[model samples]
Each structure stands twice: as C-alpha cells, then as structure tokens.
Target: MTESLATTVRVEMVRGRARFIELRAGTFLSPRPLNVEGPFARLALVGRYATLLAGDDLRVEIDVGSGVRLELVEPSGTVAYDAQGGSASWSASVRVGVGAQLIWRAAPFVITAGADIRRHTRIELADGARALLSETIVLGRAYEDGGGPLRATMQVYSNTMPLLVEDLDLRNTAHRDLPGIIGRNRTLASVLLVGARPAKACGEHETLLAGAGALARALAPHAHEAQAAVDASWERWSELVEGRAV
Candidate 1:
C-alpha cells in the first residue's frame, strides 16, 4: 500500500505581497488553524501537484478586522471576496493558483498566477490593485562573449488577475532578428504600479517607464527594463503592505 495520509499545501498572507509571502508546501498544513494577527488570511490549496486551473478551488479564510472570519471558496475558474458581513461575491471565470515547476536548463519557476482575470474581483478593485509588471531580460553582450540565451519567468497575480507577469525567453537567434525588441541585450526589469503617486503616475505605462529610462543607461531601450520594473514593484509593494493604501 502506498504510504499516504493527506497531501496539501497551505499559504497565508501574513503581509500580502508587500513585505513577504508566507507559503507552507507540504502535507501537514491541512486541518490546521491559523490564529495569527495582522492582516492574516489562510490559504488552503489541495492537489498533489498544485496548479491553479478549472475545478481546483483554493480554499481561503481571511479576517481583516473585528472577530468575524471570512470564508472564500476560490475555484480555479473563479475568485471570491467577502466583507466583514457574511455576504460573499465571486468572479465568473478565472483561475488563480501558486505553483512551482521545473523547467529544463533554467531556474525552477514559482508562479502565482490567475488566468481569465476579468472574471474575478470587481472591475474597480481589480484594476485598482493590479500593477501588470513585465520584465524582459536580454543577456550580456557588452563583453562580446557575454551575449547568450536565457530563460526565466516570475509571475504574480492579484484579485485573480495578473499584477506582475515577467516572461523572458532570450535566445541568440531570436535576438538578432528583431529590432526594438532587445536593442543592447541588457537585462531589463520594470515595476508598474496601479496607484502610484505624483511623478510616478502616467496614463500610458510604457511611455512613462521608457521616458524615465532616457535619462539613464540602466533603463535604456530594450528588454532589461523588465528586471528594473519588477524590483521597483517589490519596493512599492512593501510600502503597500506596510499599511499604506496603494
């Protein structure tokens, strides 16, 4: 007989995406209770291999303030929100999950993703919270021998919507064929915020981030903006996590 008890993974938003993500990937996390304080929300995801898709509901228990507990059943195809009142609402068609998979010859990727984003969260709140960050990294070519292939993708989502989606597939062949794609082959990371303050807010995101790069080489034209963007979001996220309404 296969030695099996119950395999499950548990995660909690001890601080949301601002400071850190508290994730417990294992079997014993289930049937457990969370009594912690400070914006605590327990996430219970089932399945031997965790992947957010249809039919998989991410069971969530959140308590923001007061003594009331909010229970949310986040189906892979849906996202739900509950207030201090017992009232609950859900998104129509969306898939949100946190998972890790091993890809060949590249660093293992941990993806917190939500597809069909429009289905979850109210339109106002979802759009208000999303940052939609992208990082396209072009490898080193300044040294003549540094230009090469690279692959990595780190993604995060909110309200069953994509907040940060970093996709990097840099190959020498693809690099040479495209212009304005990866001009100098420099690594680019960019952070986009939905609710940025003055000087950082721009109706058009790309233009704003790109224009900021014109003043420096690190953020110059190309895919490297991706990395810079991601980093900036983390800082901004940290600020948001620290109780600052974003």
Candidate 2:
C-alpha cells in the first residue's frame, strides 16, 4: 500500500490573543503545538514518515488569521529515500491574513542517493501581513556521492504582487558543481522576508559549501536580519493604516 500524509493547521485571534483553533493530521503524520510563553505559538511535527519512502505523498497547509502570530518548527530533518524506479513528493501551502505574522523555521531536507523527489512551497499574504521563512536543501548524505533528481519550486506573493518565485530542477550531482549554480556545494540555504515591500536585505541567493549544521549557523543570522526587516515594515504599515503617515 502506498503511504501518504496530510496535515492542516489554522490559527486565529480569540479574545485579542492568537490561538490554534483547528488542527488535523492524517496517517503517519503528527502535528504538535507546544506551549511556549509568548505572543507566538510553536508547532512541532512528530511522525513515522518524516523520512519519506517510494510513492509517498505528503501535504501540509497552514492559515493564520488577522492579527495572529505563529511560528512553525520541525524537530528533525526530512530525508527522501531511494525509490528504486518510483518517486516521492512533499508540498506545503501557507496563507497569512491581513495584520498577521508568521515565522517558519524549516529543518534541512536531505535527498539521499538514488532518490527521486519533488518539493513545493507556496505562500500567499494579504495586505499588511508579514512573514519570515527559511529553507535548506542538502543534496546527499555525508561522505557519499550525491543523489538523484530533485525538482523544487517556491512562490510567494502579497495579494496580487509577486514577491518571489523560483523553479529549480536538479537532475543529478553534476548540476551542483555548475558555475552560478551550487558550485561544488551540497547545500543551498534560502531566507525570505515578505512585507510592505520585498525585503531586499534578505534577498540573497548563495550556495554554501557546508553541511546541515553550517547551514543552520548561516540561517540564524539571516533569520534575525529578516525579522528586523519585517518589524520595520510592520511599523510603517501600521502608521499608514492608522492614517498617521501618508
């Protein structure tokens, strides 16, 4: 039997506070919301198929209502195993309402040797919404040759204006060494901050010649940088919304 998982989470403002109002998970998928003392709530993923298998399909959807703040975290990394002649896929879709904020700190996604996979991320934000997101992709396991084909796509938009869009199709390890591409790097890290305008400070696309730990180190500073940008944008937007600034 082919394995599949689907999880959905929704956050909304209740009595002037953000709370998780709805959460659902399918087979082999688990979503746990941790009790952290702050305006932002943390969500952890616990599952049996964090490492996907052949013919596996996984989907995650998250929605943040107006004035809500939420953070998402993965306890561990996700690995795509060799599917022999088959393939696997994982996708996530996020929606942020007006005046909402989201911080998604994703763990590394490793493509093991001989694995064929496709990953996609789509985020839509309303006017006055802000988000800080990060992702890391590792080509293969440590001390081993790289993996098989991996096609990844990402699209971020605010209302109708496109903030960022990327479509990468990597067939094999050779593609990683190509100039202007990964350039002999096995890991690729990306951090995006979307708000009033595109956060150009966080718009850096560089390949990293390091492992997952190094990627995390590289992402930490960028995450903070992105948060700062988002905060600034929020202040500006608030001023405009309140008619204090033209």
Candidate 3:
C-alpha cells in the first residue's frame, strides 16, 4: 500500500511569548515539540514512516509569525528502502515572517540499494527574517556498493530576491565514478544561511562535499558523523546570532 504523510506547523507571538498557534499532522506523520530551556521552540518528528518506503509521499510545511523564533529537529535519520521498481518523494515548504528566526537541523537521509527518490525544499523569508537550514544525503548504507537514483532541489528567497538555488541528480554508477561530483563518496551535506548580507567568505551560494569530517573522510563513514556536523553548525549559528543581538 502507498503511504502518505503531511505536517503543518505554525508559530506566532502571543503576549511576547512564542506559541504554537497551529500544529497538525496527517496520515503517517507526527510532530513532537521538545520541552527545553531555550529562546526558540524546538520540534521533533515521531512516526512509523520516518523511514520511508517505496511509493511514499511526504510533505512538510512550516510558518513562523513575526518576531517568533522556531527550531526544527529530526531525532532519527530517514532511510529510503528498496523500491523494487517503485519510487518515493519528499518536499518541504517554509515561510518565515518579518523579524522571525528559524533554524532547521535536518538529519541525514539515506537511499538504500534499489530505491528511487525525489526531494525538494522551498523557503521564503519576509523582510528582516533570518533562517539557517541544513541537509545531508547519503547514497547507500555502510559497506554497500550501490544505490538507486536521487534528484534533489532547493530554492530559497528573501522577500522577492532569490538567495540560493540548487539542483542535484545522482544515479548508480554515474554517482560513484563521476569525479568532482561525489566521486567515490556516498554522502553530501550542505548548510545555508539566509537574510544576511552576502559575504566574501565563500560567495553568496556554496555547496561543499567530502570536506573535513565529511562522508568523504572515510570509505564508509557513519551517518552519525554527518548529523553531528549539522548540529554543531546550527549551534554555532545560534551562538553567533545571540552574540550579535547582545
């Protein structure tokens, strides 16, 4: 049977405190907000299909009201199972209101052998809004030689101006043999910060694969390493923002 999941989360300022105005999950998706001491609200995912199967379609939407701060986390990583000639897709759309802040530290998504998947992310930030997002993708399981095809895209905008746009397609054989494009690496990771002035650091848009601590570090790197990098990045970003605000 084909499975589908859709989740929508909305947060707004209520009397100077950020509150979840709307939180809904459909079908096989579950949203669990964490109770932690922080300036931002944190959320986690809990459900069966968190490890997606063939013919699964998952959609996630998030909205942050003006002046609210929100953080999203995926406790466990997602793995795409072998489809046996079937396919799956996952998409996320996020909108941040003026002066709102958002940080999404996503877990690694692995595509096992024989799986076929399509993933896309679209984000729109209102004037004065700020956001930091991270994503990691692994081609196959540890010690696995091959996996199915995957096409991923990301589009981010600040108000009406585009901030970042990317498209990546990887398939068996081509993904492994192509030099400068994953090469022998099976993992790819990226971090994006929007609503900030373009920096000369690495240009306005940057995509790095197999760098320090990256999956390229070893022949078959554990997914936890990638997740740790993402989490650390987010923590550093939050500290930077806090320091700036002070």
lDDT of each: 0.29, 0.68, 0.70
Better of 1 and 2 by lDDT: 2
Root mean square deviation (Cα) for candidate 1: 14.6
Please report the TM-score between candidate 1 and the true structure. 0.32
Q: Name the runs in model 3 displaced over 4 angstroms.
A: 1-5, 36-39, 198-235, 243-246
TM-score of every candidate? 0.32, 0.78, 0.83
Best by TM-score: 3
Model 1 misses residue 243 by how many Å? 4.0
For residues 1-246, what per-residue lDDT tens digits would candidate 1 score against the true structure?
A: 112232232233333321113333332113233343443333323334343233333332211222211122222221212112222211212121222110011111112112211112211112222222222333343333223333434433444444444454543434543675656444444443332332444323333332111011133433334444444444444354233544
lDDT of 2 by residue, 1-246 (tens): 265657888988877767888888855557798864334667876666555788888788899999777878788878888888888888989998988878776777888887889999998988788776666677778765676789999877778666677788897657667776656556666555566332122223322222110011132223234333334433443343333544
lDDT of 3 by residue, 1-246 (tens): 365657888888877777888888855567888853334677876655555677788888899888878888887888888888888888899999988888776777888988899999998989788787777788888868656898888877777666767787775556466766655666666666666532222322333322111111222255565455445444445554343621
RMSD of 2: 7.5
* Model 1 regions lying over 4 Å from their true place: 1-9, 13-37, 40-144, 151-168, 174-178, 192-237
Candidate 2 residue pairs that clash: none
Model 3 / residue 199 / CA error / Å: 5.3
Best-matching candidate per lDDT: 3
lDDT for residue 186 in candidate 2, whole number 0-100: 65
For residue 163, give model 1's deviation from the true position in Å.
6.6
At residue 47, candidate 3 shows an lDDT of: 59
Error of 3 at 93 (Å): 0.6
